[model samples]
Target chain A: MARLREGLRVQLNVIQALTSRELMTRFGRENIGFLWIMVEPLLFAALVGIAWSFIRGPVNDEINVFAFVVTGYIPLTFLRHSFGRSAKIFVANSALLYHRQVKVLDFIFVRVLIESVGAMMAYMFAGIVLAFFGLFPFPADIGVLVLGWAIYIFFVLSLCTILAPVSEVSDVVEKLVPVSIYVSIPFSGVFNMASWLSPELREILMWSPLVSGMELMRYGLFGSAVTPYYDLGKAFGVSIVCLLIGLILCRRIRRTMTVT
Target chain B: MIETRNLHMDYRSGHVTKHVLKGVDFTIKPRDRIGLLGRNGAGKSTLIRLIGGVEMPTKGKVIRRMTCSWPLGFSGGFQGSLTGYDNARFISRIYDKNYSEMKEFVEEFTELGSNLKMPVKIYSSGMRARLAFALSLAIEFECYLIDEVIMVGDKSFQDKCKEEFFEKRPDRALLLASHSLETVQQYCNRAIVLKDGRATTYEDVSEAVAVYKKL
Candidate 1:
């Protein structure tokens, strides 16, 4: 157990180094090196909100579309980035993996850590910017808001790590990445609430852990009495299972990786 | 000490598998300057890759006492799209070392002038070689697995490398895989001749050269 703990600590250090390198290379020596990390996702959410506003009229009458989009968009963006980035990390950086110290899990952890932290900062920035513009809506229950974010991050990390090797081995998954986003549109519950759906559809959609997360987040943000039939316990369970599966795949594939 | 016990490696491209290394047993002791000599298809580079931990053996083990460094090709451990400086930063990050500390040394050794700011893909092969050689030397490692010639760089840079890397870093062990027998005689005291995925060590460098030449 002590040896495992020490090994994990060392892996964490490697993740930290890779994260720092990604941050530096992505932003460069510019003054706004890291601030852009916050700005990029916030702007993406804003653009999406603006585009959605054109079709949906005025977003939510009681709840501003900006805030609604942020709660949904920020978390979803983290999920997509984590899954997308982590899946291809081994193949993309095979050169670095040649070194014995640089493990496959270390690469996945670095990317997930970067995307997760970047998304978190983007959320905070979105909140601050919305508040400044009088477009902010405070969560009705802060506990649920924090819990939703935690669950979303956990699930995204697991999903990405599990899918990464599969994506690398087959070009089909890589091509379907964008297609998956379009498919996930309705299931993610980004545009609607669980309470608004028919009970059957809602129950089925609630099976999607992301939908449950989004619905719970809305309950916290809107302060409305919404008793979601979605299981938070299942969401946590699936996240752990996905993570373990990902870890197993990574261990099996590490030796087969060859830098092109 | 770095050693491979009955190492076997087979590579599969499509339908057929090429048996690259067939039960090769060799050991590299601490501070053992060994030269690897073989023809193109003699599994010389493959053996180095196995020892460097770049490729896993099919049915054996590569035991290592400490971390080993490998300079496999011209642009080793570098992203061509990134600038020279960015690549340096990436190396330091991967190794868990300080980047700023090696900045001056890299700048002096590479002597790439203003080209350091440009993407490495834009640089000439010699320039790329210089960058890789410099980066390898920048990081201190106990053992080095060098493939091919280091003389691909300019004359002055090559001389500087010998002075600093070969003469200065005496405690560092080297496993040089090269076709040049003269280079092997100059740099390596011991020789390992690999044929049909097996290694036969020679105490006399002349004997190893003769064996390789006959093949």
Candidate 2:
């Protein structure tokens, strides 16, 4: 518990540095500095929606294709970027790590918070723009939607912390990032609801916490029926386990990993 | 009250382990100023690092009954992109202290003037050395581990350093590691000369200088 308290304090300091640097370096010395945070990600979502228009039919049948893509793209963007950067954090901020008060977990937590917050803000902006154009109705349940996003963010943060060190040592894991994205693209549970999966298939897929998180999110926000295997118990279990494993991995490699 | 018992450090590079500190022991008491003198690669810097908790020993323990500052130098610690003022804030936060007082002191002492607001990477070596020295002195550690920091700066700042270090912080114990004979003799009472990773204690400052000179 004492360690936890200390970790929280260190995390606060890390966040201060991370946010200051991110805001300063990214926005630069321009007048429309802060506005770019929302604009950039929404632009990417727009581009993807446009590209998908030509590749196939609609991106989703249940909702406006753009809205569906925006919903899925926002969280995943945060997940991917956080994981990618967090993996190399120890190397990137060696100076900060050498200080006694700065911990390995603090660095990872700061990166996760910054990326997740930025992505969420961008998603909110996109939602407002789409609403103005009458592209989709306001979300059915704002509370559930927010909760689902929070849970998904938590799971991804834990997973990235665990995978970061492993990815650093092996170029194989780095190369596999996009490949994993491509493979998981079909199973993202965005286009197809988990309710449609066969009982056996649902049971097997629930083993993947990412899929479980997405399925649970869909149910919470859209009142979509989840497969019989959609267990909040399982999602919570996997999240807890992954977080513990990640913490252990972080502790062991804290000293060995070179700060960049 | 600081001591290391049977401390051993091995710097491993792929296939070989080069022992920097091969089973050494030493003790430092309150207000006891000690100078560590040795030739290049004699593990002088390594010893200071181990004592400061920057690096852990492969075997044995560093019993620190008080806080110890890391070796004073403009090295791989400060963020190059941050201004000296911002860096000072970070250093204070990490040390769990107030930055306002130290920031003012460092600003006045470093004499970098407008350069304090500029990124640290843009500062000259002498300016960096001054900043490093000022940062170390700003943090009120129970024991300071000085490494090759006293040799820098003009005669006036050097005198300022001595007055502040000796007169103001007389109660603070110091472990100064340097090759400069004058610094070792003037700043420290007891001296430890490291040779091939082994530390030998000298009763008089002059005796340690003789050993250091021969090396």
Candidate 3:
């Protein structure tokens, strides 16, 4: 028991250290440095929200296009960014493995953390900005929003866990990750509500943890005004399975990887 | 104490599988200065990497009972875009050492001065080596894994390194891998000669050097 506690403490220290390094290396010490973490995502979501609002002009009178885009894009950004970063993460940070205290999982964990935190901040910032303009409504169900976001974050982390290790072993997986994200965008439930889908399509889309998560998020934001179709149990179950598979694959890769 | 049990490592490039360490076994006790000797591609560095816990063996395990430093002169660990000070700070935090103290020690030791503020990638190879060596010394691990090419900069800098590793930390375990017999003879009491994916340890340094010369 004592040894386990000590191990956990050491792992935490390594994670903290790597987090600081990731921030510095990525953001640098220039103008507003780490602030860009929040700003970069916010700008991406804001631009997309405006463009999306203009592109799908007045489609649904009940829904605020700006709020819809902000809510959906924030989580989508987290997923896409996490996946994009996970590719070749292990290989890129191979130097860090030289330290006995640092593990391959630590690299993935740090990236996931950075993306999640950034996306969360962007979510709050966008909500505040839109609410100030009287365009975005305050979340009707903050509890549901938080819960849905947490589940989505878990799903992204699990997906990263799998990708980080697989990318280390295969160059093909690394090369295909970005393209895969673009292809999956439509089915990711970013632009359309689950209720808007036909019954046949909704059944297939509901199988996706991403769709379920987005549905829950929209339900939380728009409340009774929007109809949401999601099975929380199915989403949770799929996330758990993915998490287990990710952990197993990561463990196996750590055992065999040559940190050169 | 650090011990390796039947450690085997195989590297695969395309269709070729190079068996680096084939069931090699050894133990390193406290205060034991062992020299690792081998020809090029003889798995000398691979053995050090395995002992340092940087790489996993293909078919065995390394049991480490004490803290071990990474290969002392390896600059690959530093992020290229970050300044030298940032790299030192990162290492200090990870090792749970005093950040200000580590920075001071590295600054004094490396004497990089204004250069410390520049990105590490902009620094010369010698500068990177100096920073790595200084940071390793500041952390003060129980054992140090030194590669063959750690002797960087001029004679004064090399002397400083020797002083830091030998005079200052005499009781710490040293696993030095080098092709130079003189260095091994001067610093190590025991020697391990690696060949054909196996390692043979000799208590007498001269005898090990003699055997290594034959290979």
Question: Best lDDT goes to which candidate?
Answer: 3
Docking class of 1: acceptable
Residue B2 C-alpha lDDT in model 2: 97
Estimate the overall C-alpha local distance difference test score of candidate 2. 0.75
Candidate 1 lDDT score at position A133: 87
Runs in model 2 lying further than 4 Å from the true structure: A1-37, A51-62, A167-192, A196-198, A224-229, A257-260
RMSD to the true structure for each prediction, in A, is 3.1, 3.0, 2.2
Report how far off residue A90 is in candidate 3 (Å). 0.8
Tell me what TM-score chain A of model 1 achieves: 0.87
Model 3, range B29-138, lDDT digits (tens) per residue?
99999999999999988898888888788889999987888876545577777889988988887888999999999999999999999999899878888888899889
CAPRI class assigned to model 2? acceptable
Report the lDDT tens digits of candidate 1 across residue range A202-245. 87876677887777777777666445445787788778888899
For residues B1-215, write the lDDT of model 1, one tens digit per residue. Answer: 88889888888766899888889887787778899988898887778778878777778899999568865565446777678888887777667677887777789988997899898889888888778777778888888887785656677977886787678998888888888888889888899998877889998888899888999
Q: lDDT for every model?
A: 0.77, 0.75, 0.85
Show the lowest summed lDDT stretch of 10 residues, model 3 chain B.
B71-80
Off by over 4 Å in 1: A1-9, A29-61, A225-229, B98-100
* lDDT tens per residue, model 2, B166-207: 998899899988878888899899999998878998979999
Distance from true location, Cα of A165 in model 3, Å: 1.5
Chain B TM-score of every predicted model: 0.94, 0.95, 0.95
Q: Which ranges of candidate 3 are over 4 A from the true structure?
A: A31-57
TM-score of each: 0.88, 0.89, 0.94
